[model samples]
Target: MVLDTVMTTLHVLVGALWVGSVVFVAGAILPAAVEGALDAAPLEKIADRLVYLSRGSSVVMFLTGGHLAGTRYTIETLTGTGRGHLVLAMLALWLALAALVEVGRSRLVDGLQEKRVRTPAAEVTTVFRVAAVVGILLLVDAGLLASGLALY
Candidate 1:
C-alpha cells in the first residue's frame, strides 16, 4: 500500500512536470524568443534542461506506470476491456508526446547551432504546439481513468 501510494504520487508529479514544462515552453518561452523578447542563450539552456526533464520523466513514468498496471491488470484484461483500451491509448499518447518533444528539440538544436533564435523558435513552434496538444490529451486520459470513466 505504501509503495502504491509512493509510486502513484511520483507518477502524477512527474507527469505534471513533464506536461506543464512542455506547455510553458511552447506557449510562453518559444513565443517570447520568436518575438525577440528572449535570447538564444536562455532558450538553449531551457532546451537543455527540458531535454533532461523529458528523458527522466519518460523513464519515471514507464517504471511507475508499469508497476501500477502490472498490479492492477493482466494481459487478458488489458487487451479486452474499456479501461484497458484507455490505458493503451494513454501509452500511445505518451509515446507520441515523447517523440514530438524529441523532434522539436532536435530541430531547435540544429537551428541553435546556426546561432539564430527566432528562426529556430519559429521552426519548432509547431512541433512543440503539437506536443502540447498531445500532453493535454495524455492528461485528459489520466483524468478519465481516475474518474472511473474508463470502467465503462
Candidate 2:
C-alpha cells in the first residue's frame, strides 16, 4: 500500500511539473511573445532560465518514471500494454525541449550578445509560435499519461 501511494505521489508530481511548465509558457510567456515583449534581451534571459529548469526537470521525471515502472511494475508489462506510447511521447518532448534549448542558446543568446543579428519581429513570432505548439503538445502528453488511459 505504501509503495503504491509513493508511486502515485511521484507520478502526480511529475505530471504537475510537466503541465505547470506548459501552462506558464502558454498563459504567461505567450502573451509576452504576442506583445513583442519577447524581444532580444528579455527573451534571451528568459530562455536561458527556462532551459536550465527544464533540463533538470526532464532528468528527474525520466529517472523517476523509469524507477517506478521498473520497480513497481515490470517494464515488460508496461511495454506489452500501450504505456510505451506515453513513454515515446515523453521522449519526443524531451528531444524537442533539448533542441529548443540549443537553438535558443546558439541563435538568440549568442547572436544578440555578439550583435550578429538584431531582434526582428518576424523571428520572434516564429520562435514563440513554434514554442506554443510544443507547449500544447507537452500538455496533451502529460494529460494522457496522468489519466491512466495508456495503461488500459
Instruction: Give all TM-scores, in the order shown.
Output: 0.97, 0.66
The TM-score of candidate 2 is 0.66
Off by over 4 Å in 2: 1-41, 72-75, 115-128
| Error in Å for residue 1 of model 1 | 1.6
lDDT of 2 by residue, 35-127 (tens): 666666675666577667667766776776666656645656556657666766766766676566445445556655653233432344455
lDDT of 2 at 121: 28
Clashing pairs in 2: none
Residues 1-152, model 1: lDDT tens digits: 99999998999899999999999999999999999997777888899889889999999999999999999888888899888888889899999999999999989988887889999999899999999999999999899888996784
For model 2, the run of ten residues with the poorest summed lDDT: 115-124
The alpha-carbon RMSD values of the candidates against the true structure, listed in the order shown, are 0.9, 3.7
Task: List residue ranges in candidate 1 displaced over 4 A.
Answer: none
Measured with C-alpha atoms, the lDDT of residue 97 in candidate 1 is 91
TM-score of 1: 0.97
